[model samples]
Target: MSVSVRTRALTAADGTLSHRYMALRSLMKICVKRRSVVTFLALFTLSVVLINTIPLLPKETMRLPPRDLKGSTSKRLPAGTPSTLLDLPPPLNGHKNKLFSGSSAIPFKQPLSHSVKAPVTSQAAKTLNSSNSTRLCQQKCIRDGGGHASVAVGEAEMTQQTVREVSGEETAHERKPDSFWKRRSHSFAGKESIPRDRMRGEKSDLCQISVGKWNETTPESLPWLSAGDVRKMAFLSGGVVLSKARVPGHGQVLQVGLGAGEAEAEAEAVLDHRQHCQSGSCALIKRPSDWFEVLAFHLDRVLELNRSLPSVLRNFKSKLLPYRYISGNARPVVWWDPDIQHLAEVDNDQNSFSLSWPLYQKVLQSRCGARVSLNATPCVGVQHSEWGRLALFDFLLQVNDRLDRYCCGFRPDPSDICLENLLHVKCKSPNDLLLVHILVRRADPSRLVFIDNAGRPHHPHDNLNFRLVEGIDEFPERAVSILRSGCLESMLLRSLSADRELWESRGGAEGLRPIIRTIQQRGTILLQHIQNRILRLNKDL
Candidate 1:
């Protein structure tokens, strides 16, 4: 009986082992069938996470803010007004209401004149014909302070009366045969005298002249002049000084002598030749206030004056300083040799193009001296895409518009020859990209600086250094190629090296770590989903 039990136990053990082998085989088969589905799901999840995480990555890798924003801070108070309370209008329905009551103000109405009397002398009639006749009389009247008001008006009115008297007097002086009664009738009409008060008031009416002295207690005693006070001062100065002097010709050139200098010489020549004095005289003592005025006057002329004169004499003395003038806004003055007729006209539409003013300036400085003639042919190379062409055109238009507005006498030609071949030849290295960025930074450093949420300074770098990968020929082109080559990791690595501290401070490292963790977690979840699906399939099997 013991031998029989042992045989049964061994048989049962073998059957159990066989059952386990069969289950293992079925599991392997299920895994093979669902392998593709599981892999696809895992890849899909990873791609979704990567796409979502891209924008969150920190752009700057170097520099840091003066302070961190991790903790709460006190809110800043609003800025106080600089103007005094007295300078501002009184509060609604305040003292101003009582001061300017309608009934208390006096109305000074001027009287009208009817007929004017003739001048007695011929010499007086001759003086009346001159342009300064009214001016002389007005001056005398102002000096008398209303004492000579009637006399001034009488002098002006007598001139008109003299013309009528001349017709009667002309016949009498020539001893003409006209009757005395006829001459008497003419003389009576000419001598019809209007009252002095009426004539004086009529003359003063045109000017609306007022003669009143301000007492020490008057509001005029205030330290500052109001708009009305300024207007009154301008009026008192006479309309002659206020009017713009009329020049005879539209294209006339005014030669201004500027002290010796290269800039001054060029400006003088530009003015001497009567080239559009877009920038008037470099020697002009008057200074313009803003960009509009600068454009109206011309930069070259302004620069010349800055070089020639003292700070006190220079217009816009602050802007004329060598390093102070920003360069990116300047329009490129393209020059091409007319002799190079054999070169095919470049189709600007076919290529993408951008200009680095600093790089171009460096090239010019190195190859040609400071006073180098820019008449040499310029080669341009641009990418063959619609967007590239659009960008190039937009840049060109911006340049031209700025030049037209600000650069005096600069007129960009639309039909200049493009040195397409030269651009391809010159910009054939990754260093060119660095040079461009450096130039842009030099032009406007604020553009690249980081600003925190509270509008505080975030990144502060004195200077930037760029690293280029080996075997890359053109910097900009290589950058674009790297972006296209799905080498975003390498590209970002290169960019971050420029400013690593910035990336760390902005939680870029932390943000990327989370993304990586999410990707791994998603992989595990995908595996679980696959295992569950396989179990369901086996149950069906």
Candidate 2:
């Protein structure tokens, strides 16, 4: 009986052990199944946290943004004008320019003739705008960059820009910033709001170039900075130059960075009776005008005078500007860079040029081909043609700003005052001199800079205007050659016609006709005048 009972108990114990082992094995399998999914979930959460938060924090030292974002700011300080305002469309996109190949030119991209129309709204402008700090630097948080989402958004913007180009419908409403909206809630404190649709000088036609992401793929050439880079350069002294600011009701003048001699020039000009005069008649003061700036750039390019500092017409409205130009108006802004700045005078003596006061008078008194005392003494780096290039342009434009501004010095003729001795450079201010509209070639200084050439215009017979020569005798070889070739008429006309939209916007064809006619008329008059002057000077000599 005992053996039978013990055997039964052992059997029961074995059965119980088998059941428990089976249950344990099943539990282990279940745990293994859940572990993989748990690990994946944890990894995903960590990744999401890392992506969104890491890039958003302000760094101890943020890397300098791409050139496109940190564009050179306008240094010209706030200056108010009369009701007359200048508006410019955005930088154009298109083919590389053939006009001025040697000097860097902002080649405009032309839209197709058969255009389609797109609806321009406040939102569109923000998405496609050029000057916003945020838009310029928002690349870090974007996913994969190659992802479908980014591609879709970019394609959409480009498509819209194309459509607008075809339609020729421009003018966009201004959208307030998110921070602005948050700050104001309802009202903009210390700011007067202007309606975007009614925003004067609003242009919808402006579109950005299709520059792709940097470093993601191999580049074809050195990356060209966006228009914003050039447009938004550092304005070291941007503000109402108290030294030159007008009375509250009189006007406002905002100067950006004041380079070496600009401050002294401004002070001198303010006090000196010269800046207030034009056409041999001096007024108490002359109201500042945008004509000299915007028009000067266009004219320089047409004439292929690459000596001028690069300038572009920009349009924006902010309290930073004067009241007259605060409503999305256009104004000409110069981009002066130290990197490209060259001295206005070189050490080479062979390139030395000499001009006596009498020759200066002859240029004013004579006409064309007068063969004034321009001795072709071979100077090393100075070419008569180069200096004459800017001189001829100044004459055509009636420039009267630069004269007697240089510290006298030219080899073999240090005692004699010559135009080639224009010593005050744009980058460095002279202790006793003023630097006016000038840009010297980094490679050579004898090359005259025609930048900011726009200044007080003089009468045709005003013996004091025209470049280099205070007097008009004979037109330089550069001028006569260019004029006789009949290139002026076509080049000038093409330049005007090419940017017909800007002309029309600023002034319709009827309004522009007079200016065009006047320019052409001046050319004819100039030729005749030069011919007469040349004959007189030759006989006198």
Candidate 3:
């Protein structure tokens, strides 16, 4: 019985051992499947502990790689450190700072804290803590440059401040810079803003050419200098007269032969035996005041008007000229260009056309010669821009002989040709008034040649001929800009100095000051008018 009992117990014990071994094998298989998850959790816990403990370590142990390393790396300032505006880091010796990479950002050694006392705004604080600091540096650098490279720091700051003020004014609609470059500074401003490529070295415009001191080989400028060629003067034989009317000193200008049988190349000498007067008018045909013509020519060239005929004051021996109009005094000789196309005597006055004042206004509105059109009623073969140019030239120097020959713009003196000829009486019927001295060259049909430019320099300012600019809405941007530039005086003086005869006749610099001052005053008034018009246009828009 004991043996049977012991065998049963042993069987039970063996069964228990088999079940335990099987359970152990299952547990080992489960552990092998979850081994990766267990390892990941262990690593994550380790990292959390390390991250929390890092701030407790000494700063010396947090040192970055050596500064000599070529690799790109940013060295951030310690937390809670105070940094002033524009306080830049020292430049790395051999490596480019990632902050200023690929940019011309100027890093000032001085900080903004030295000058600016305002507390840093929240936006600036955010910028300091972020990468936006790089952009801020770039903008500051551009401001320092003053739209040009290598500007001095002191000047750059002043220029930058001025630019900001100008920008503020623009935003307020007070005024705006006419040019893109002008927004940064005024010194580089231009009327017809030249392209960057074209602005290299210096502008090659007519104004620029008029600059520089003159030498003997080149007196005044090209085309104005007569090359000192001697010629023979003679009266037209057979008692022939070009016109029925007789002018001041000489009834008619004597034709001087430039070369044998070259009648086409012959130029006319306007004889004036009277003592040279600085101001006042002459006869209807010629200027009795010879100095005025010479002054007008220089003024024309200096202003880059390029409209008046080239005239020079030359002293003539009484014997050299025709005996009929003998004068030993200096006279202006005008180039009688064959290229000019003169109107017939039947066309109103022999020197001009029969267009009435109302018709003139209509023509300006039509914009003649701008483009080809079937309608020819308003097309006068003259460019639309030419009228604006003419108005501006006439307003300055107060030359009213062309546009306001009837003395309609201002009060005329008793001795004035317009009043003496009863021309002002025609102003009552302005629609019947005719235009004169509006000459143009056959070669350039669209441009006008300004002749008989007898400017009234002594005209009273209160009596300025505003009627000259009556129908004109737009002026040449280049001319208007020049008027506003304040350089007109200097430029005119430089150009006029080249003409030895004209310069000396006016008694040099001191004598020329008054005339220049008058022109400048008129320029200021015109500029104000232009600004008002521009503002009016903007409001209409």
Best TM-score among the predictions, by candidate number? 3
TM-scores for candidates 1 onward, in order:
0.13, 0.34, 0.52
Candidate number with the higher lDDT (1 or 3):
3
| Model 3 lDDT tens row, 19-42 | 999999999989986897898988
- For each of the candidates, the C-alpha root-mean-square deviation to the true structure, in angstroms, is 40.2, 27.9, 26.9
Candidate 2: stretches off by over 4 Å: 1-288, 318-325, 339-382, 404-439, 455-482, 485-490, 497-502, 533-541
- Candidate 2 RMSD to the real structure: 27.9
Error of 3 at 462 (Å): 0.4
Please give the lDDT score at residue 228 for candidate 1: 42
Runs of candidate 3 exceeding 4 Å displacement: 1-217, 220-253, 259-288, 318-328, 346-352, 371-375, 535-541
Q: Please give the lDDT score at residue 433 for candidate 3.
A: 78
What does candidate 2's lDDT look like per residue over 13-86, in tens digits? 99999999999999999999899889999999999999988876531211111223221321211222101111
lDDT of 1 by residue, 1-541 (tens): 9999999999999999999999999999999879978999999999999998878653211111112222122221122211100011112221111111111112121121221233233434333433343444345334413323223223333333211111111111111222111111121122233222222222332222222221112223221223343233222211111011112231221122322344544544434322322222122112112112211111111111110011111111223322322222221111111111121224221112333433433432332211233333231221112112121111211222211111111222333111322332333342333121111122322111100001001111111001111111111111121111111221122222222222332344333333222222222222222222221100000
CA lDDT scores, all candidates in order: 0.24, 0.34, 0.47
TM-score quality measure for candidate 2:
0.34
Estimate the overall C-alpha local distance difference test score of candidate 3: 0.47
Task: Please tell me which model should have the higher lDDT, number 2 or number 3.
Answer: 3
